[model samples]
Target: MASGLAFPSIFLLESHLTEDELESLKRQIRSLTTDPGKTDVFLGKLSNRERAQFELRRLGVVTVEKRQSRTRASARADTDSAPNLEESPAKRRKTGARAPSPIVISGSSEDDEPVQIVPPPKETDTIKVVKLAWFTESVARGEVLPLSDYTVYEGRRLLAEPAIMPSPAHVSRAEGILKRAQADAAGSQQPQGGKPHFMQARRKKFDGMPPPRPSLTRMTTSEKERVENLPPIPEFLHTTYSCQRPTPVHGPNDKFVEALKTIRLARQLMGDKIGIRAYSTTIATIAAYPYELSTPSEVSRLPGCGPKTAELFREFQNNGGHVREADDDEADAKLSVLRLFYNIWGVAETTARSFYNRGWRDLDDVIDYGWKELTRVQQIGVKYYDELQELLTRAQVEAIADRVLEHANSIHDGFQMVIAGGYRRGKALSGDVDIIISHSDESVTHLLIRRLVLSLEKAGLVTHTLTLSTANSERGQEAVSWKGNAPNHGLDSTASGGVGFDTLDKALVVWQEPMEPADQEGDKAGETQPNTNPHRRVDIIVTPWKTVGCAVLGWSGGTTFQRDLRRYCKNERALRFDSSGARSRVDGSPVDLEGYYGNDPATDMLTAERRVFEALELEFRPPNERCTG
Candidate 1:
């Protein structure tokens, strides 16, 4: 019989887990759940307490340190608190008794000693972060183990973060900016056609009055009248999951969605993960909304759209369909510089912030100041920043896909490919191309990415190899099954192990078109010149035939669509869905929903993807219809 965990629920922090390793852990812990709110313990391959705390913080689980253990508390406080105190003379007089003096053993006066204060006791429940080995060892012994030896941290999870006290400089800067904006507003409102004296008096009047701001407050109408005036919320909107409904490429509220996206981008640059998620949820909900928002009440009617969201919508309507924060965010100098650094291929938001803190303002600054400090991939990113930022046309993307397919087929026959990412989601242009390749023969797919990338490099199509991972192939192209019976995934903290959910044999490369012969109009007419094609980012993924359906479905949708799909799978089907494949959460078995629809391997990718939707009991949404922006 399987033993229950010592903790009520466990949250697996996704730091260093391959497909198989994740399944193995889930199988061992029967109480594993995705929501961090309900989790009592966090288990991961954590190094120290700081990392454990950071993982919790990243998931929006704010926490505070609870009271120390009795042993530690006693050591920190005075050994004899009762003997350290002396009664007041006034109290002794009132009681008609002599006061006892505090004992001073070191031949010093009692008044010479400093006072020691004790803090109040904490009453919140303790949250534990234990090492992964503890659980495995416990399972091996067929019993739950004590967490003392393997515990990394013990704290109390905060319901919400405490209010932060801003620094003096921050407050001063905010005041200065507000004052400047008010001055500008006053200047713009001054009369231009009046005489000098009249204009002077009008300016004086404006200076004494506050700038006219738009009203963002909700309407004071009764609930009955409000409901009668507002449109009924759609049935699909009732569900917060985007995967349950179709989100088209473009919606009636694109303008509002774009405005919200700008704010979200600003939040990303500022390293506000929680803010980014909040804005992303708002944008996805609005993108999936079918009606054009006419009133704040209508916006409020949408699910996940509360009074605050409605106020923002009201502000947008009052300001001629523009969010004030979005405009301000674009004009902010600090954000603009951070945005520039963040656009580099190898730099994440945190790295971008680091660059800003290091006083590097632009690509030239990065090259001149931090060239030696950069990673190989970061150096390449700086070298071709502009070329990589250029968007690729549909024709260019198709041509690149064809070239990749050609190289792939030459290495092995009977391989099939699907163009995923924004292109598959019906975008006219994409920043990069994502190609998911597979074959019916599992042997043929083994370590195929390395050979394909080599061929492309030899053909002069691949300029730079950013990262190459063979995790899937190294595991023998088999779907991860949890029964405590699968082989070790054997992943480490290396680039080759692959990061995140896309744990397939893959290569991230900088691709450029091969040089074509160009006729010169000058003295050297007979000589051929190099083609001036721009470099593009490309990701080549190799999946086994059985799970190709999951791979395609995982990579084909928008970011929100993919996130919500995984959430839906976890919440509804008790399955974990990723680009690699799906696994049952209850027993860690491979959820076989792919490659069962057809005999031909060439057309199996798409049909298999549809089969995943059917098997999961979800409405089959086409790739183009998954634009959950």
Candidate 2:
């Protein structure tokens, strides 16, 4: 095989010598793909230069000369061929007439499907939109209504944030108006129920709509080709019913589930096709700009605007959707509703729809109806429901933390306790208070915990309790000695068998009980959003002192932060840390931080803090200061 010349496309040039050389050289090339057995066959025929180009291509990279090869040839062809002149083809389906809008179906209450979704661009300030005449009347057509009146989920979460797709009702209304206008353009009287004067006002609003179109006339690169190949509207895919969140919490949360589902569906319909930029970061960057540029080119001067991505933004803004295809997207519609309902606690897909159909729209109705009818725990749930809805302020979090510490101190000597959640996070607010309790004397800790809950409840601080008993040291040793022994908590072998987050206790209680319930479903399924109750969340855990570090570390985190921490701990530190314990990944050697070691919860927190700091070699900082992106 030649090492100097480039290879032609697989579909194009082939020769006996090339084929023979390909087979011979194939024996030497290594395969990286899953089909390892076939790598050499593709590599055998290529010359060294071609192989180099192929490797780069394999990495999703296109070489300059390779790109230039087609482009230069095309340029020559374009010079020879007459430039085709034509209007952009219309996207509205024209099978004698346009189609109707689609009816969206979000998932059940227990499901975590998105009800509504905003199609935020994966790139710039542009949305790929589809334009068409009003859908057929037979379809479920509805207009996007005002935010406050319509849903529990915000538009960002509840509906397909289609840049230009009108609700069925809105599209019909617009179509009716436009038909009259088009008729007026020809020679005709205005249609009945269609007031030309009123349409003019609506038309003014329509004309002021955002513009969109993307063009990559900047630098020529393979990335440009990649961008050109991608359409703005996402390709429709298979659907599945899955829970987005499974919080074993009590409350009316149906509306929230629907909303969340809608959000997911809309996303599936939109920018999922192209790109991976952070939305908050992207929005912040765009928002910082002084002037609004509807097209991507206008903002090309800004940093991070790759030529290919910029084209996409410009095009998205100009067009209501992708360059073509105006079929009513059912996926987006379904997602819109799901997103609307998922925002509420205890809300799921099925319950959200029920509430929507019954016109029991808001949180208030559910609270009034379900509070008394739900479980005692759920009844307590309704009491603090509103307070829980609000993110806790820093002061409120502190008060909760002190209350948690009070219970911890009383548990036993050498018992340790630390307040986590948003308060320890140093954030100004928190959703719920988290308390981690542990003790060095693992043998008697469970006994202390049981007593602690009873006392706290009697003191009126602990409103509800969920206990998950764990194996003592002796019990663990005995289990290991036995051929088959399992912790009754039902945690898997790979993870904790203990219930809850760990072998822990969970409780939800309001500081002040404003209203007591009779008999009601508390945290029951398919519950509606609360309207009458003020409820809040509270989580508590008790791990032994040896595992205290892991418990605290897990507790003091944002989602992504925790993810990265785990990666670092496992991959870099080769450590295993769970709510129960922190041990060596290679061998279960216990991690012991001697300083401040104790069965006392307070001392345990200090020791765990010190241990983590030492392991990471970082300066000692309170949980509040641990926030990391």
Candidate 3:
């Protein structure tokens, strides 16, 4: 009787239902022990078969009409029921049927009929569309009701299945495995005395001694040599603080580091923030390693590299410098399309995934199907996707930096600038340019980004401004003040425009150099000027003189180095560091590390930056030696 009340997997159609109404129905469905899935029964407000089919198709479900012939349907059901003999006991229990006890027949043959474990009709791929009132009326009556009157459509699924329902092939394989396990257990019974047969076999395998662990026995020639002449581990590597280490541009294990970077990129595209952080630490540690990697054990010895990291390294070595997961990630059709969308200037991982889910396979699809749904910045990004992804050579980057600096000084004289990011890290090419600008006077730096952007735009050097954050200036050029150790109390939420760390007044813009005079001198008959310079992405950050040190240090280091620097400050020094300034974590007081070099307001920006390193009790790492990417 209880088995008669079991409902097939049911899916709720979101169309034609209010949010609250949908949630209410979902709660009732959950109370009835019906979980969400690709289901044979679809409950909805729909009343017609065509409307039901349209709703399913709209949600990416395709179906076909079930055969109306009773004989054929009965034959198909019989064939399907035979396979149910392999269904797991757990699923049978879920359907309110008791699992049968295992029977061991002495002379049972392979050709014998399969033992039925439960008494219940098997479910099929035939779908039925039931009106919403059926569910509500059934819940009101406090008993499961028949669906014959409420069902509007009946069809065979073209392609869909419940996720938890194992295929017949899988069930067959599982049964075989279970038989093998039972046979092994029955044969391995203790023989009258000492130990089990398996235990005796293990003892005889290694001459009565326990076998050596796999890791210790798999050393290669280079690994053996590396062990013999082990290099002195750098003292800084022991701390796990990237700020304490010097990470050069080209490390001894750069090739391996680059390979790991591919995996990190995949993690980023998948929006796995924790995985990204973990891989970043490992990548940074490998990038800073002084010796070449010969074995997985060598990687395992590093601070952040765990056993999994070492195993991946071994796999990487075996695959001729490629990680299998990274290769698969790159080759995945969905991920490849996602990567294309992610490379667009303003599209984040979430946005890229959203675009893919919307059935937009490419940029053209996005433009065609969802152009109006995009933000202004995203539209601009799509408009210049190829141009934005083009790499900028060092010379071109320098030119852009020079132009930015010139524009900054034009808005307010005596502005000092440092070209940060990949260019400062000695990369031959950069995807974008990051320039940090500062003025000795706080008043000059306050709200300076707006004027600078206006100046650049006026000169036709700036095409679009994506973001203009003045959170630092809004807070009167102050650092984020910390609250006492109470959750959600006294924190300065307005210090930064976005979340975490950085709060400097900055402008994220698209830049294109103005046409040269020679190119501007086109035919006198009103020909348009040819702008040969390619469009480039640029970030201009403005910082007050007092906290210029923090700005330079924060903006110059690689992503991991900057992240670990802030982490080190919080954990070791009880302070918070960001592009805005430093503040004591214990209380909400600012920490002035800039004035240590000199009382002079006009001190050189590099000297101020060095003063920060000295005050933080860390060695000053040159920009080129801070490439922990």
Candidate 4:
């Protein structure tokens, strides 16, 4: 019976409703089920009202009431009394009755319900009859509104107020005003009396007739003012010390920094120490800057940026962030010398230039003509020149660290190894791998580096030992006395301070990966086998458990960061900083920091480092944030 209720129309109406509208309809329907009179006050459009009637009928809560108009009654009398042909299957179900068999209207039995009569078409009935049904249902539901108030567009059933069109007179006046505005704009662009303005006249006279081409350099007054009045450089950009600023692991001013670095390198090559220092300071400052700079003026106000530096920046800006190589013959020659000297492991700018003055041009030249003059370390450096120059990838570093750990554990259990240096600081490539080994028991690390290297060498991992020093060796005593005797010597002293806290037991070695079966086969077949996998430089430093934190912190660095850390310790805390441990300057007593590091073996190194900072009243910095440019 519910099928005759035109329930399909409700689905069609739902298809057009938005989610929010559907939810609202659902709420209204639920309310109507409780209180049928609620549907009577729903003031929605005819479509909504009819939709509600269809839903109510489907729920078996409402039945349609037929009306006997004159046209409908006449049509009904003419039709044979079967269910009306115009009645849909859905309408038949609404009455809770089966369709009747053919019978005369006057012969219909009282047991059969009367079906709705179909209305005949009228000449004045321009509106669709289905729409009239919706209107009638809306009225029954008490959605009372004037017929003239309803407006629809296209085929959509919308409820909107009728639009009012503007009068023709008002439109004409608007058009007149638009034409006047266009005329005024055209007049303003032309000179008075079609004669040139004073500035134009002067430009024409002095320039001997202006060029026919349009000028691209011209700017309006506002644009000119904006160019002259840029925002001031931020206070943070005024920093002169790298340690005071927080430089991210990566930055936006890479192009600028690269250019400055190249110039600094060139200066170093040219043996201009002062120039190198100046450029380093400026490069560090720029690298630490947070924003990308577009104009030279943006950096003109920064410290360490002199007139020459400013001009270089402007030139770089003009060249689209690229720096061209110097074309001067003298500069190029000096650069060549600088490159040659800088590549030698033990050679500094001073030594490189001295060799250059002695007529050495290339590594071959140095070997052939001055090999005898080279130090033993420099000789080894030349022998493995190509191998030492190659950078170590993070993966290779980790593999080496694993091998080191394997060797350390063989000698004693519970030994901890940390891969420090640039690798620890998150650099993708490093010059060498630095490994620090320690154990909770101090006795385990007494001769750790020496025993570890012997084991690694026996296993064919360590190819050559470049240096080996034990903690109790006489060399350590000599190193200590060297520093103690020279109180006024700068931190750059290579004999003592430059050896990097010589008290710690350490070794430097050349390492190579073990040859696999495939590599051995290739070597036997003489198939131009790989060049022994290029010997890599590795440093192994063994420290007692108590000082492992200081060792890790000291060795993990960007060079400038280490320098500043030592400077801070010396100036601010009156302490001497070193990889082994920190000691008081007054009486050379160890500054106990054991309390900060709890007894946990896994986290003791980190905890101890943090405690060192706390003990010294300094803020702790993470490895990445300690870039210091």
Candidate 5:
């Protein structure tokens, strides 16, 4: 009987474990579930009676033992008939048996040994299927659902997976939907045919809309007061980003923009680069405004306008639509220096200041003493200073463009050219003509700048080459790639303004219209040479046919407009925009615009430009409307 009796054994239950312990126990249970033989060694280590109890525990059987003293043990010989506590709780309840109490085991070795118990099967509650109407109602009420309520499932099981939150694209879509709905609601609220008198009165009161201004001569006292007290236009009419605004070639606020731009230019002339940038944003904003401003309140509503600008606008209004100018000896001297510095193409405010500090006063002083110190490009700039200062008429630029195109096509039959810069933006006159050249045959684009300039120079159409650098030449391989008017010897060779201004294969030349046969005959007949045709500045940029659109777009800039476009591409599309091409910033891969709008670059350049906008997920703005500055 003693041999058959089982020694006391401790049993561990799932309810007794902590969260971390339960996790570890579950892992162990999964291991056993896959291979039941894994528990053999653990069971073999126990004593015979303990092993029997562990086996019973493994089989979901429980045992309880009651101890009696040695003297009382002989009196009770029916220990085998003792009630079993190893029975399931259901069975015990049915037989009117009390549940077993928890026992504390005591022993140094017993503390390390715990009996493993399988957890009972969990009961799953049926999930309520969510209806689509609930989502619609929540969205209608502008209520966002709790994050936890959103769940992802795999087949029938509720997966313990993370939820994908809404992205910017999703939020934009939602906002668009809401705006359309609001517009619809407003449309429905309007009365059919004619509005009721009360509805019209309500609209007049709540709209905060401005009434048309009457002529000063015809205005009644009450009407004048009403016009003066009207609220400024809504903020939505103005946008923080200049690229989103439409600035026509000729704007209603031209005078205000010009005045602000003059101040900005003065700041630049005084070497105030920070001030120049500050004024640039505001000037661009004012230039894009569609209406001519009449009050300080109107200027105050613009995005970049500040107190100073508002005050300036009010002063302009008081002075009958003109900015007040100051006349002084000191201002005249500075203006002279500003005009002189501006004539040098490669020189900026810092370089101009450097020249000023060196005690150089005028163009003659630069020509006499500072001639040797000037950069090769600056030397050419000073040589043709007066000629370059003269703005070219649209007809002059077009004729030059046509001549260049004729020369280019003469060299290669399929060559293409686009007149960019201010001319492309429909300006009546431009400071200079910028032309972008390309060819469907990519191999022709490799050294096209040198080839075309050489052809033009031979034809006597090009007066002088200020700069003719291939892509490799600009990148500092002048020894092998440079082919232009200036010698490779003693070149500055460093990048201008830190990074190179542009990366396209390009040439800047002094061009004069070829002497017409009549003019040439007149020259031979000594008719004073017809004013010498005044050598005008021309820039020729060469690019591959695939990226000619990018070159044209980059070159046809209203300075601030180009800056904002590049910023938008970088921040919104993860792209790097340049004259050469647009590329993904992520992997440095060239982004092709052809697939975006199904346009062939080999045919139409404007279509290609439109495709670039589409590929970047940007709205296509016409060139004339891009005069942001």
Candidate 6:
């Protein structure tokens, strides 16, 4: 129904329904599967090529063909003869290969052109999922682990202190200090009898301050008895959205991390006494929260800010820009190694430290010094550091997702897959692909990862395999509870259990590595082999349809969104989740996937996710809107 449904060429005969509309259609169809008629009507709206998406969404499948008729009427007419609910399975079957799949295209041409690529096999191996963990002892030890160390991204709330309005007391103190300073100047410049003037107490005023009263925060006798006992902090909550910690920012330059480190260290030394503060956690969010500004009120009426603080905030906003100083921090940290370390897809803090101990200070140095320490993804990150960081094109991501989805289908029935992460957020380009897959057959599921990897590798489409961990994954945060420096988490940090996951359907893991320029490959020993783009990290997750929604929601998040969702679910909902299962209060421990959510074939990913949202008591977020900052 939308424009731009043109037929490209003979090879790309599929209608060009601009990828966004198509992916959206996929997400939508997956959401509404209860009605066969609705499914038909939805599919019936699209042209033949567009219908491919609907097919894929319904069955984890799709097929492609050469250019076909452009006339809308012809497509409309054909829609009448399409698959119907009443058709028998065998009769309904279409010629699998009589028609080529539209999804088989990879960017590389078949000796075709610079940008044009032949449709490779519908399978690929360069995608994978790695289960992650960090120890409690490791966190407490200040092990400098990856951001994966902390369990809770719990931010202290700036509560509107209705009862304990402590601000006036502080203001009174400041006013007293001002009065004392005036008196001290008026009386004597020198300390009186050598007693410091700053030691003097401030005068109190009876002005607008509220009446002194008993603390309302303390519960009344009746209220205490009536209030239900709330759960504790740091407990694991059952999450429909299983939290998956993300890989840290990496770069090719060893010096890059060093620079960041050195600068941070210098700030601690200088700014600590001088109050130097870390600005943006990542280079990405710097503009939103700067290092230093006088004050720009986040809201018109901040809790602590009286008229004066409000004025100051407004003045700061009006004057020099940011709340935090962006560029002024000393770039004292060495950056070469940081840059190099940045490229390693899953490089944790400990790993980064290992790189540092080895004395690799720069990208060139890492190449020159510690090549062995680098993972395939890191090497790729360095090689194409510039390119990988560049946002992915909408078209490019969609094409790749198609291949991965098809591979999931090949694994077996009850097997499901979906693309999550940034691309799911509707971004044209993405950092890397995030995929989830799952199925009911345990044995067949066992074979899913290996077969997928082998198939994809044999196709010559996947260049390298970086890491792999099968699902039923126990690789969640290792510590009982992350108490010290660790990554942020919501679902895992309930007062109940840890993270909820029984056995994942199966997780197949692979990573993309950077490909050297054609001419440059001659320099490396193993570089000449095709498909091995060293250092680009990719992940594939497999989950049963029962937990597919959890996987999708978990993986479909921006960093903070995941944290917030978990916070609300675990803290507010009183459910406990661990990496392997969910805990219920009426019962004893975590519930198995089948038991946690009832059995239903239609309880697949897109549908199941709706269930999770319903449990969370929130609106359903389509893939595009899911990427909340």
TM-scores, all candidates, are 0.66, 0.42, 0.66, 0.57, 0.58, 0.45
Kindly list the per-residue Cα lDDT of model 2 for residues 347-447, writing each as its tens digit: 44445566556555445765666545544544444444556567767776666667666776766555556777556656566666676766666665554
Q: What is the lDDT of residue 451 in candidate 3?
A: 86
Weakest 10 consecutive residues of candidate 4 by summed lDDT: 120-129
- Comparing 3 with 5 on lDDT, the higher-scoring candidate is 3
Candidate 5: 10-residue stretch with minimal lDDT: 151-160
Count of clashing pairs, candidate 3? 0
lDDT string for model 6 (223-244, tens) is 3453333222111112223231
lDDT of 5 by residue, 463-512 (tens): 78877777633543211221221111211111122134447677888888
Clashes of 5: 1
lDDT of each: 0.74, 0.42, 0.74, 0.59, 0.60, 0.42
Relative to the true structure, candidate 1 has a C-alpha RMSD (angstroms) of 15.2
TM-score, candidate number 3: 0.66
Q: List model 1 lDDT by residue over 34-79, tens digit each.
A: 9988877889888677678778878887666665657866856755
Q: Which stretches of candidate 5 lie over 4 Å from their true place?
A: 1-238, 324-330, 472-499, 521-531, 596-602
Q: What is the C-alpha RMSD of each candidate to the true structure, in Å?
A: 15.2, 23.3, 14.0, 37.4, 29.2, 34.0
Model 6 misplacement above 4 A: 1-295, 298-324, 329-340, 353-359, 374-387, 411-415, 440-444, 471-536, 578-581, 585-588, 592-597, 601-603, 618-628
Model 3: colliding residue pairs: none
Name every residue pair that clashes in candidate 1: 482-588
Q: Distance (Å) between predicted and true CA of 238, model 1? A: 1.4
- Of candidate 2, the 10-residue stretch with the lowest lDDT total is 236-245
Report the Cα lDDT for residue 175, model 1: 60
Candidate 3 lDDT by residue in tens digits, 1-629: 22334465678887767567777766656533233334678888887776777776676665566656678889898887786566587766666655544432211334333332222223336778899888777766767789988988887654232123233544555665466557668885433433322221121122123444554336678788877777767887987788789899999888778778888888887777667888999999888888887777777888998777788788888989887877888788888998899888778788888898889899999999999999887898899888988999999988888998887777768989888778888989988888888888789898888888998889898988988889889989887666443222211111112234237788888899887776777578978776877788888888888988887887778878877787788779978777777888766689988773366543778888998898898899999888888
